[model samples]
Target: MASPVSQKLEEKLVCSICLELFRVPVTLPCGHNFCKHCISDHWHKQEQAPAGAEKGYTCPECRRAFERYPELEKNVTLCSVVELARDGEARVSGTERCEVAHGELCPQHGRLLELYCEDERQCICCVCSIRQCQRHRRVLFEEERSKKQALLKESLEKAQEESERIKQAMQELEERTRNIKDSSEGLRSVILSKFTLLRKALEDCQWRTVARMEQEQAAALGHVGENWSLLKDRLDILGQHRERAQRLLACPDHRAFLQEFRLLPSPESPEALLPVEFDVASVVEPIAEILTNVSRLLLEDLPGSVAPKAPEPVGQDHRNLTFNPETANKYLELSKGNRKATHSPGTVCGRQEQGPRFEPWQVLCTQGFGHGHHYWEVKVSSHSVILGVTYHSLPRERQQGHKFNIGLDGGSWGLQVREDCYLAWHRGQAEKIQEPLYKNLGVSLDYGKGLLSFYGLGERTRFIHSFHSVFTEPLYPVFWLCEGRAVMLCQRD
Candidate 1:
């Protein structure tokens, strides 16, 4: 009932492999036609050979095989029918027209094919090109294809090179990052080690300082405790005495008790029963002795020796002592003397001519009193003999309030007159001289203003007159004793 065209089209739809209407038409092994690329792709996927050769694949439907190429011509009738159908489908889908200039058709050719002209700015088929591409350079499809092929090759090579470079760079960056991480770890370890050492050192120093402070504190506390105990004992004794006195006084017949209490010496005069000389020495010697010892100790510990000793409580005698003559002399001499004498006076003086022309005195001898004031005396015979003190150990100056012998070379003997002046001599001279030169002698009468005092037999004994007034300048205590006649006395009272 259908038309011839419809019938032919129906026949064209047969499957080449099955020789029937094409239903999922599949290709055969003899280069025969089939549906789409179905049978051919199947054979390729299965890794099979063509159907015509001796070892070719068999058809899935008929199992046919050919030893040689089969008569596998394209079905003209079917092809014609398919072409017609395609044309009809295109008409329905709307065919695209060429976008050439002015809708012009080529005078030489009627069919259209995609082609380009350099200046046309649009696509043109072969027919449209002869008309629109007159003034523009034409690019044929084949030529355009060749040019694209070359460009594609170059682009592929460039892309390959770029990809390789990117891969290499990534590898290098990874290596550098790893190295940086390793370096950071190493540095961290070193820093931690150093910090640990420092921490340990700090802890050690802290512990040492703490230990030293604790020791000092403990010693101080012990001393304070001992003093407190002594004070408590003394208070108990006083309390007992008070109770005894109160009980005796409470009775109406207390005359005998009153007499006994009166006979008991008052606490204020505790030294009444003790020897006077002992009392005096006990009171004064502590002061002078302490000064001498302290001054010597300080000198010995010059330039900061071991940690300074604890400060001992000052004794009663120490409180009574005034100026330390030796300390005062050293302080004065060091200030006034030249730099050479200040540093090493003994060394410098030993090298001087005739040993500096002045005799060096043991101005601060430690033998007499370890910690108290002691006195020395000297006698004057002719008066013309120059008597002065020189510190072979150091120099002397006025600011320290010291005065040595009376003679020339800035000595106290130079004719300066005033009151409240006194002379000091050695121990040997104290007993021999009953009267002072100021009372009898008249040689150099101009030097008669200053008074003289002797120290011997445990006391200051005599007085004399000299040429000087009150001593203002600091002096070294060296005297010129007359050859066999003069004497020196040492005493403390």
Candidate 2:
């Protein structure tokens, strides 16, 4: 509602002649104001008055006559006033009244708080708006509150979603923790069983060694006992001879002594005894060699064998994937339960119109990986094949000046098999790596660790190249084959 003071001021500023707010207000000699154009047009009409009509100029608002054509002068002060009034009205007329909740009253006016002063961030009444908050921005209290409520709801929803995500992540981590513990326990059991067997074998070897040493010791002691017996017998025989000789000498008969000496012929020299001893070195040398071998084994291999190995840069998730026929180009043929994709030039397969098929000589796999380790192997018929992984965002159109679009941008990576060497391509760049052509190739995608590795699958899986990047989208295995070349997705149960 317009205040009385503003209403009266507006009435004063209005041009009564035109019945609207003055524009370029001008004052005439009759002390009345009107729009300059309105007054001029009125006098121009008077100048063209009919011959019978009164030919004079008069004020349209006051109806007072002027003797001569009064030169119109602009009412500058009144014009300024009218402009101020209209501008103020334009702002004040946007709204009439608003009722605030909670029965709050404006502190300045002691009136109901009908409006919200956005600039002041407070509630106000009409009186206060017209007085202190005339130039301030204001809105209905409910309007501002609704905006705040919307923001609060959005924030709350986001927070709730975040909480749910966090909880899910926590649960996954807990499950992984349990799995780790169980695996550790199982591995411990296996290691313990192996060590126990090894210990038993070692103990058996020790017992056999000790038994051999004991046998050697007994043989040596028997030989020593035999030699001692022989020596003792000879010593007894010599004593008997000595007694016989003494008896002869006591008989005081040289003849008797000579006969006793002849009869008691000189004792035969003691038989030569072979020296015998337990050959400890012979017994221990074999064990020492075994110990030496064991020491070398522990030094050279035990550290690696006794514990789990470090993480492999590549993995063997061994996913069984097939070609996605829907995304295969017309020139490509899928066979063998869609596990093989062959490029047959001039062969057009009937395809749906506007289908999501590649224009290039390329095909995608049915499976895609977003996280964790994933691996797949492929057997190529010949060289000139490109194997890699690509985001779904890869364009289906043929690249300019190229038959295939794989590894042309940030969305894909490729290892192109050439006749001489392999080419690692990404982001419009190619790196030439001279190597043998691997007919059987493997690809490993470690999504969680952001590693994509290509391998040459021979007797041993050989690392060819790898891509390290932060992957945002799930990656699908993609391949491009040259004419007359085919690729088969190796299946592992």
Candidate 3:
């Protein structure tokens, strides 16, 4: 639907380098039109002239040297004319006249044979061709023009194909980007939800632990305060009795009053006062029992089931086994069959001893406290036998804890404590055995005449001046130290 001139103008207006409509059109002083960006980029590259040449550079099309700035700002009349032609408004005017001989059209081509040289002004008809032109070393205008047209046509087709491919690629890229955005949004939502749940769980755990600790602290304070009040009342009564006795002695009836005072019973010895055992069993035992039941239920049932759940709370029991140092000597003596004839001690049952009164102790059970590691402290009193601790459930090669052969060279007696407060002692310095200390506690050792005591309950064990006696027996409930170590000690109650 467009005129031929308009189409031709559109084709010519396209940039030779970019093969697109010219943007920021500019012209060289020689009158060749090109996109401003394209020409300037080309000029910038050539500005650094070849070696040994003048610093000034020349136009690529016209070979005319001009100042750099002015050349860059040259008016582009040809580009404007081409644009107008594309819009069907261009007029051909003020152009150099075509130089043809006698105004005759060429015989080979109907078009006028215009002379392209600036000087010499040679003009000839197509019929009368010059021999110099036929055999000329330089390229003829007609041949050069034809070659340029063919190259332009090829470039136009290639550019069109490339543009189409780029458009398709852009569409695919947009689609993929949108999908990635959607996936990112979905993942963000899921992470936020999980974070919220975890925060709430953490808050609940904090509040529960705080409440339990506060209750225990309050109960302990109240019990201690009551004991203090009772002691104060007893002291007051003793003071009153002492004052009355002093007054009677002053009155010369001291002997009679003394007799009356003797009728009153002596104050109870503080040593005889039995320590109050709060029997935390009521509170802690149920939880432990429940956890044990839960463990049994879980272990007994098959992996897949749909029925009653186990009593899982037993798993929370973290009480560690502790040893009594005084009992170690008894165990060592029993292991050596050296009990005195004066009294018969309890029988030592379990595996028979193959060596000289030394055996290993086995783990009875293991309780886990899911939150963190737990600890126990044991003390040893006498070291006449070997003592050791191990987790039998674990691999044999992976046995852990301390073991010592006591009294081998008549060294000072020492005590060894296990991860659980289980204790053992020897009569002499034993071989130093590295033991894995509990995660949250420290170990302490004390030695006295024929007694060696060890403690492992963190820093607090250092402050414990006294201990309450509990039931003690042979290694029936616990394991035997056949290969590792064991100690002899008297059973305590």
Q: What lDDT score belongs to each candidate, Candidate 1 first?
A: 0.39, 0.79, 0.41
- Count residue pairs with overlapping backbones in model 2: 0
Q: What RMSD, rounded to one decimal, does every model reach?
A: 27.3, 30.7, 22.6
Descending-lDDT candidate ranking: 2, 3, 1
Per-prediction TM-score to the true structure, in the order listed: 0.32, 0.37, 0.30
Worst 10 residues of 3 by lDDT: 464-473
Preferred candidate (lDDT higher): 2 or 3: 2
Best by lDDT: 2
> Model 3 over residues 287-356: C-alpha lDDT tens digits?
4333334433444343653432211122332233433212222232232332111111353444354322
* Per-model tally of clashing residue pairs: 39, 0, 46
Error of 1 at 376 (Å): 65
Between candidates 1 and 2, name the one with more favorable TM-score.
2
Candidate 3 stretches with Cα past 4 Å from truth are 1-154, 248-251, 254-493
**By TM-score, who's the top model here?**
2
Candidate 1 Cα misplacement greater than 4 A, ranges: 1-111, 118-123, 248-493
Candidate 1 lDDT tens digits, 173-236: 9999999999999999998998799679757855764575566566666766766676677677
Worst 10 residues of 1 by lDDT: 439-448
